[model samples]
Target: MWSLFALLLGLVVGSFLNVVIHRIPRKESIAFPPSRCPHCGHPLGPLDLVPVLSYLLLKGRCRYCARPISPRYPLVEALTGGLFLLASRFYPPGVEAFLVFAFLAFLVALSFLDLDTFELPD
Candidate 1:
């Protein structure tokens, strides 16, 4: 049960990390602007932002613009979820586990960002 919760939590965090990976390089406010279709700039609603499920249901296309969404979104989400599930199975919940989770998430964001920009953010 706790592992399932960890997976769900990681999925949600990975979705936000997607935003971070895209926005940090551009120096955009990650929080001020909600998730939007990059092509049409349509704001995403709750259903449009349900982590991997939304991407699959949308058929890898933007709901508003019909542009092909990057496969990376679901990939990151699933990766994070899987990582969290694996960690939960191995580590007892506590500060150390929290640090591990945070470090894993930071690594995920940094890796994707570095792939795009080739420069690490401070």
Candidate 2:
């Protein structure tokens, strides 16, 4: 049950990470504008925002414009979920595991930023 909780929490956090990865590089506010389709600039609806399930259900295309969605979103969510599950399984319930997860999330966000700008954000 704890592992399941961790996985769900990780997925939620991964979704937020996606927002950060995209907005941080562009110097945009992550919270002001809700998530939108990059290709069409269509604001995503609630149904379009489910972690991995929405991607699969939408056939990896934007519902508004039918543009192909990037696979990275679901991939990151799954990866984070897997990592959280692993952390729960391997580490005793405490701050250490939480720190590890936080560090991993930071690394993941940093990697995404690096990929986008080819430079690390300071």
Native RMSD of candidate 1 (Å): 1.7
Q: What's the TM for model 2?
A: 0.92
Per-residue lDDT tens digits for candidate 2, residues 33-120, read 9999999998999899999999999999999999899999998888888888888898776899899889888888888889889897
Clashing pairs in 2: none
Q: Judging by TM-score against the true structure, name the best candidate.
A: 1
> RMSD of model 2, in Å?
1.8
lDDT, model 2: 0.89
Cα lDDT tens digits for candidate 1, 4-112:
8889989998999999998999999999789899999999999999999999999999988899999999999999988888899888878887788899999999899
Backbone clash total, candidate 1? 0
**lDDT of each structure?**
0.91, 0.89
Candidate 1: C-alpha lDDT: 0.91
